[model samples]
Target: MKPLLATLFVVWLSACGAPEPATPMTQAEAVSIEEAWIRETPPGAKVSAGYMRLVNAADAPARLIGATLAEAARAEIHTMFMQDGMMRMRQLENGLEIPARGQAALKVGGDHLMLMGLNTALTSGAQLSLQLQFADGSSTNISVPVKPAMGAADSHAHH
Candidate 1:
């Protein structure tokens, strides 16, 4: 009888007020960006590419919908593939997807971020910031360093 009374009292207290709502995870909080770098552009160059490793730590998949840079008029997600015995690059109209508990690579000669219409030139050893927007409408800003265009091959080789 006492145990039943205690259980009823607990239920009554719980019914007195809705349980505090669980805080939702924002898109930016669910994903982490790693190893971000942008290739240096030559003088008067209007475009350059950036690469990064996107790690999705959440249970659900995350999509990289867009990116923005103050130094460029616009930024876009792009991919390069073999076409007709030649390499062709195209913009990803629907953006890029990172699988749940998996990762996506924006490496050279592959899927990458393209910064077009550069109003300012990017030089080696310089740094810039870009905002990464996700499909969930949450965005994260990351600081990217500029590296010499010719110093390396696949960066993953070093690690």
Candidate 2:
């Protein structure tokens, strides 16, 4: 009987070893952003692009509604798509949504942020401060690193 009791005690200890569930963060802290970067602009360019990964850890969906930056006169969420065999870009005024426990990526040749009417040219190795606003009226301030496009030889001439 003593041996059986010891075995039960060991089983109970193993069950207790399981980790507890993580505490839910507030609405302001539910969104997690990572890998924020701004594309370097060519000389005299007035426009550029920024990219990042947005994760929603809350139980409800989160929307990235708007953005602000001192370096640009206006910032907008945009998406690039193929229409009639031509690439077209459009503003996403309604914003982008990330489902609960899911993520959305702002990437090249896809959904991204458009920084228009840049006050100055974006140079490599510079840090850009951006404020991202959500639909719930909560905002997150992030510092994005300026760098050339990764493994891409694209020019900002069209921008």
lDDT by residue for model 1 (1-159), tens? 999999999999989978799776776888899999998877888888899999998888899989999998989998887767866778899889998889999988789898888998899888899899999999999999998765454322211
lDDT of 2 by residue, 1-159 (tens): 999999999999989887988875654589999899999888878899899999988888899999999999999999887778867788898999988889999987789899999989899999989999988888989889999888663433456
For every model shown, what is its TM-score relative to the native structure?
A: 0.81, 0.80
lDDT (Cα, 0-100) at 17 in candidate 2: 84
Give each prediction's root-mean-square deviation over alpha carbons: 6.1, 7.5
- Worst ten in a row by lDDT for model 1: 150-159
| Residue pairs in clash, model 2 | none
Query: Candidate 2: where is the Cα deviation over 4 Å?
Result: 1-27, 153-158
C-alpha displacement of 93 in model 2, angstroms?
1.8
